[model samples]
Target: MGYHVVAMPYPGRGHINPLLNLSYLLVSKDDITVTFVLTEEWLALIGPVSGAPNIRLLSIPNVVPSERTRSADFIGFLNAVFTKMEAPFDRLLDQLGLPVSCIVADTFLPWMTTVGSRRNIPVVSLWTMAPSMFSVHYYFDLLAAHGHSPDDNLPERREEIIDYLPGVSSMRVADLPYPTVGRGGSTRKHVIEAFSVITKAQAILFTSFYELQPHVLNTLRANLPVPIYAAGPSIPFLSLKVPPSKPIASGAAAYFDWLDSQPEASVLYVSLGSFLSTSMEQMQELSMGLKASSVRYLWITRSEASSLQEACGEMGLIVPWCDQLKVLCHSSVAGFLTHCGWNSTMESIYAGVPMLTFPLFVDQYHNSKLIVEDWGIGLKLKQRVGEEYVIGREEIAETVKRLMDLNGNEGRELRKRAKELQETCQRAIKLGGSTDNNLNAFVRDVVQGQCNFAN
Candidate 1:
């Protein structure tokens, strides 16, 4: 009989996309059967999963409000995920015909660990962020011990350098994952509880390559109780041999057409993920910056920012969304202006595109730091202290010019490093590479019933 695995991702685009990619990879194995579970609302929003019949898409009723309704109230959504989703999730599992051999769930939903334990099923906690960020989360107790707990005066201490974390060097307190110093609230509590229960999982799966953060990954392997598997840069595992005839979505033709017209490595692609919304002032400033930079660009913005197109002049195109992976993979694209979400960061790395980071929230700050400092593949937009979090037009323009000016040493070096990292990312997914070996070993362990609770 085939090994039956069920995968559950947290209800966010960043979380869902990586898990879906992982499901696709797992189903490629002949003796594996995979089921991807999500809330009905989210399922409808994301549409269908296009894959072999061994991979099934299933959904439970979203007992709480949809992402559209609760966009402003993140805590409300977290509370619902913690309190409301469990019963329905349990029911879904109980009704499944195939005896579930294992469960793979996002680290955000720790309650799933309890459910899996109760059912005597091994749960592999899949962390969708960079392993460096996971190291930060795993060491929350150390943060508290070092007088950097969430209860501290965060704004005042934002500039403090955190050099004490094992395997991490010269990191600022401000760049630590947001939850480390977040204000006291239900969200903070939920995050703390989530990390605490992660140890209960039979094994931990990171959507990162071992080489991307070798020191941090090594530290985690030595200290963590469970087996740690580096199984990713998961996006590349989903790549196809032939390019799609058109972009995945209908309205992206004009944008891709514009890309087709641009010279190789000349355009900067800008996107800030799906959930973040910038203020009008920031949006206008960004528009002015792009206009002033004199470089070809393609930007994705919400309908609210539609008016800013007047400022962009003929410099670039602005669309609501497009096939990001396709755009990044294009020859015309050079650099990315990003909010430093891990998903975007990995995609950029995969495409060998350098970045200009303007991190908005959560782990983005850390991801930005990694891109700019650790990996040497990007630069950060400037932010002034005690001022409203905004990048002025001049600073944005300067940063863009510095990145795109191929004659300049900085730009050349950044692109060189980005290309090197891209080769590393590609190698990791190929047969006998680190990620391939890790993933195969993990699957074999699970199939052989070798995974067990660490404690």
Candidate 2:
């Protein structure tokens, strides 16, 4: 009997992809078996699980509403996961013929701690965000005690500089995770409660690398009782030979062909992720801005912005979707205009593309800070006026022009830094690299029942 690991991700594309990548990496090792658990709906949508011999897919009932219907009601989905899914999950576990050795679960689904504890199985919590963002969640109690807990009405609190966290020189309160401020107090409390469960796990895995945030990682290790593993930028380790089970959006070949026709480092790629939606007003502003900038660009959006196609004239290609990774890797992609989702952040970093960040929500603000302030690899889109956040077409156009300016010193510098970080990300995932070594060690520790607090 080999190690039988049940990998459970929070039923979202961003969360599922990394866990699936980890499963693929694990099953590639000898004498390892991984069962990736997903909702039946997602499994069907994802098409198939293509991986090593030891990898398998399992689905539970999707009690929550479909993403299209629940796009605005994320809290309802979280409530469903918390209240409805456990019984089905347990029953499925009981029916499995193989004795499960351990469980790897998304950090957001903290109830996995209780499930693993009851079964006497070691649970590894996988945080699918940046370490800096995790640090804010991990230290939420301390922040609350210090009167820094976000209030719905207190917009001024965001500008206050946070000097307490280790290795972080000068991050503002604005740079902390989004739930801390934007969501109501109850949502904030819920997030804190969820993350609190991480302490109960035997180990915690981060989809980040030591090189990216060494100070934050070290701080977490010092503060947390369980072992912490930086096993990430997981996309690189993922086998590209096996194509994505489904195309993420549409016009896959046409987008690539369009890229082929453009000059090297000339096109800006814009995507705002799967879950977030933009207001029609914002969409119009973005469309007008792209037109005003006169930069050749590819914009992937889920909304009906067909009017923008004629508005953009010959300068832009507006598609519903494209293979994001493929588009990013294209020679013509000079910059990314993104919402700064962690997956997008990692992908952009890996692809060596500079960005014009227009972060919309949760953790994205922090990610933008890292890109613009910490990493110096991207420029921030100016959207704030006084305490209110607003982006006009002219502002967007100016930022776009600045990012795409090949002859400008700032644009050249951003690209140089982005490319350098891209190489670092590649090196971290390659054979014998930091992420590879950490992942291997984590797997070995789990199999041998030796995972414990690493001081």
Candidate 3:
């Protein structure tokens, strides 16, 4: 039977994007079809899809709460997702004309595993975060057994090493994804449930390359009952192979022109994040700091760009949005001041741009540690004083100056390491590279989904 895979990602940018990228890869192969499922509301939010004729986007009703207001009452939203979504989703599956050969689902939405089990469909659990984070969550019991608890992360014991985890390096307690890091309100229960149900899946897909976390991947493969596939960085490598007629940096020709006028490796590319940002006070302080440092910069943000530009002076250009990967790859772009989101981290690595990590929440702290400590491709920007976590303008200025320093030994070494890592990423995406081989292996032998005659 021909391969007809159905993908249902949790309606979040981070989760949806990697699943879509993986779908693109699958549909690129012959005799394969993909039906991507989303809430009707989310489909409208994401706009249109182009290029792949074999891929189809199918939607269920907006049964869950609005994405915009989700943060307000996250627990209510979680409950809705857990209880309200599955009936409509399963009904939508029944309406599909084609038999679902395989179901690719986000690991966060554990209910999909239930759907798979009830229907006897082969499900592939797609984990959007790092394998290291997955390892921590998958083995939550081990953490408790080793005298660790989520609420027990004391500041005095912050630097204590977590040496017990298999295939994981001993790191400080502060680096574990905890202590103001969780999404709160049923999130832990859902993730733990997600891990528990993975054994029921036919396969598990990690949105990371083997080179990035070989030991972690190996550990997961050995521990899990199902087969595991490393789907790689999940960036837009396909675009590079077959260039678009217009640049992916479309509608930002003005910014590219601005970058072109700058000196080589002199401009700092800044993007905090789309969701969850710093406080207004900190934002104002950062603007003044960038201005004081007098470093050439291009900042991408969705909030109060004009005011930020006024505060930042003529040294920086503020845009509402742009193709981030294209901006990072530009020659004039020196470094990235980032929120350390996993997607942004992977892009920074792929572009070989050393990072100034300012982690805010969730897995970002863990990612920051990997960048600063494990990878040696980034520096930590710390400026908290006393009880006020808000970083001051003077401190921000000093850190920005240090990161963008052309002549400093620390900057030079970071640049060299970043370049080396960039080269490594480039090879990993090549035809015979680890990622390419792994992807080929996946598409060549993917499991089929439900194919009932009634459907």
Candidate 4:
């Protein structure tokens, strides 16, 4: 039998999608068997949505059901899995028909480290975000020692400046992810625990290109104990499979058609990713902004934000969920307005679209910094209160006009740079690219028992 590589993805669209893609990559190889273990909720989403063959799907009982899950519940649910599900997972592992050789797990799930330990299977932790963000989490220990913990009651203003990051320039505390800035000791404790488990991992895999974060990757490798693997532009890897059923409908089909109607590099695609919440007031401002810009747009509206469709109708098209990659690849999409999620960032980079970043929670702030400051492919907005917060009509109109204007030579340059990054990311995932090389070497050397883990 081929080597058995079991994967356990964190629950939610963000984590599950990338893990599924990676599993697909592993399964494509001649001598590999991928058994993807997911929660019941995730299985519902993946089984219905993806068409990954030669891969096995195994569902574990989610201690919490889908209806009870909120954005905040994710961490708690993972903690529960760590504490309560070990025996069940062990039972599953012991009963496997094939001999398990290695464990490829989410860095977010620290509990799996123990599973690998007990089985003598090398566990490689995958950080599915920018390496810059990993650097922040990996070094959060020093921050805690220097009084950056939630228990310290760090002043709101003091949290504004993240002056210590190596290549991240001009970052403020308010821009940091919620877990990093909050007084909730629970989140802080969880982050430390997660990274602690990560340190014991046999290797670290990042869903980022080495060229994108060269300096930060260097610093992280120096500090981290394991070999760091940059395996990314995962969307291209995932999109290789055509889903059994179309993930979007004919109504969504019109959105892409409209994209084709726009001039090359003229439309703005706005999506807040899969897991963000927007208040009515914020939604209204966004509507007015798009209306005033007179720029064509393709916007993704969630079930809750569906009400704002009427307000944004004339100049923009709103769809429930889109084939984001397909839309971004359209010649019409010039720039993206996003919540700065890592998956979204990577997708935008792969599509060569510049960004207008308004980050929400988790590594988003860090992703935004690298996009805006380091790569010069995007811009960040100052957070404002009251009516001005959600891209007021004037600001929206002005920003879009500027990004599209001939006088906006800088933006044109940025667009060129984004294209360059896109090419580099494409090469990084190709057969001879960095990520492909690492993945192949990993299977041969580590997963196939050619090398042993650290003592």
Residue pairs with backbone atoms closer than 3 Å in model 2 (clashes): none
Off by over 4 Å in 2: 180-185, 241-252, 385-388, 452-455
Clashing pairs in 4: 159-173, 160-172, 160-173, 161-173
In candidate 4, which residue ranges exceed 4 Å CA deviation? 48-51, 65-68, 72-75, 145-170, 180-185, 237-249, 304-306, 382-391
- Model 1: lDDT equals 0.83
TM for candidate 3 is 0.93
Model 3 global lDDT (CA atoms, 0 to 1): 0.80
For model 3, how does the per-residue alpha-carbon lDDT over 1-455 read when each residue is reduced to its tens digit? 67889999988777788788888888877789999999998899876778888878889999988888876666677667778888998998889988777788988777887787788777788888888988888888888787665546677877778988888877777777754322454456665676777777777888888888899899988887677889778876676566635434544446877887899999999999876667788789889888888899999987888889878877899988877888898899989999888888988899999999888766787888899989898888742212247777888788888889979999999999999988988898788998888777777655433222111
Clash count for each candidate, listed in order shown: 0, 0, 3, 4
lDDT of 1 by residue, 40-141 (tens): 998898887664688888999988678886666777778788889888999999888999988999998889988987898899899999887777767878
Model 1 RMSD to the real structure? 2.1
Residues 1-455, model 2: lDDT tens digits: 57899988988888998888788878877788998888998889877775466878889987877866665566676777777777888888998899888899998787888888888888889999999888777777667776776543257777787777654557777676655232223466567778867788888999887788988888888877788999888664364555645433344447676777899999999998888777778888889999999999999886775887778889799888777877898789999999899988989999999988888777888899899989998988844412135578999999999999999999989989998999998898888999989988998897556655321
RMSD of 2: 2.9
| 447 Cα displacement, candidate 2 (Å) | 3.3
In model 1, the runs with Cα more than 4 Å from the true position are: 150-153, 179-186, 247-251, 384-387, 451-455
- The better candidate by TM-score, 3 or 4, is 3
Q: lDDT tens string, model 4, 1-455? A: 67888888766677777777777777777778788887776677666434545678887776553624545565455556557666666778877788888888888788888878877789988888877777677766655665554334344554455667655455555445555322223566677788877878888887777778788788777767777877775665456345424334366657766776688888888898777566676777777887887788888977554566777776788888777887788788888898888888998998888988777666676677778878888877534312234656677667766665534787878788898999988888778988788778777776787877772
For this target, which candidate reaches the highest TM-score against the unseen true structure?
1
Q: What is the C-alpha lDDT of each candidate?
A: 0.83, 0.81, 0.80, 0.73
